[model samples]
Target: MISIEIPRPSRRIRHIHIEFGTLTLDYQAGAEQAQNVADQLAQGFPELMVTIDDDVRADLPPLPCAALWD
Candidate 1:
């Protein structure tokens, strides 16, 4: 199995909105917020799929995964 590690959010994250199907999760958080969310959703990974909206950052080069961002 391939592992996907999400970068923990920092203070500047300010806001994050996530929606899937008819379910919507909207929140504002600080460091480690993403980790907490991931832990909550960890149980369903086998059946989960995601659609991401991307805005390329000029400051960083394209990486196979963004896990290193933090």
Candidate 2:
């Protein structure tokens, strides 16, 4: 996981960005799984921006990329 901390204007924590590495499932199939992961994380850590780094999108041949941020 990649952790990024950003500062807010109100002197509070802005948002936390968590990046998960290349997931080895079909892009479409893995989306639901990814959402569930994000939801679970949100339950414990509210209002974070969860991101996945599924390298497949970058590896795919010339087409619009898939959405990995939820």
Against the unseen true structure, what C-alpha lDDT does each candidate score? 0.41, 0.43
For each candidate in turn, the TM-score is 0.33, 0.32
lDDT at residue 51 of model 2 (Cα atoms):
53
State which candidate has the highest TM-score: 1
Candidate 2: residue 18 lDDT (0-100): 48
lDDT score, candidate 1: 0.41
Clashes of each: 0, 0
Residues 32-69, model 2: lDDT tens digits: 44555557767886655475444444333321132333
Q: lDDT score, residue 38, model 2?
A: 59
List ranges where model 2 is wrong by over 4 Å: 1-29, 52-70
Off by over 4 Å in 1: 1-14, 44-70
Q: lDDT at 30 for candidate 1? A: 33
Model 2 lDDT at residue 21: 56
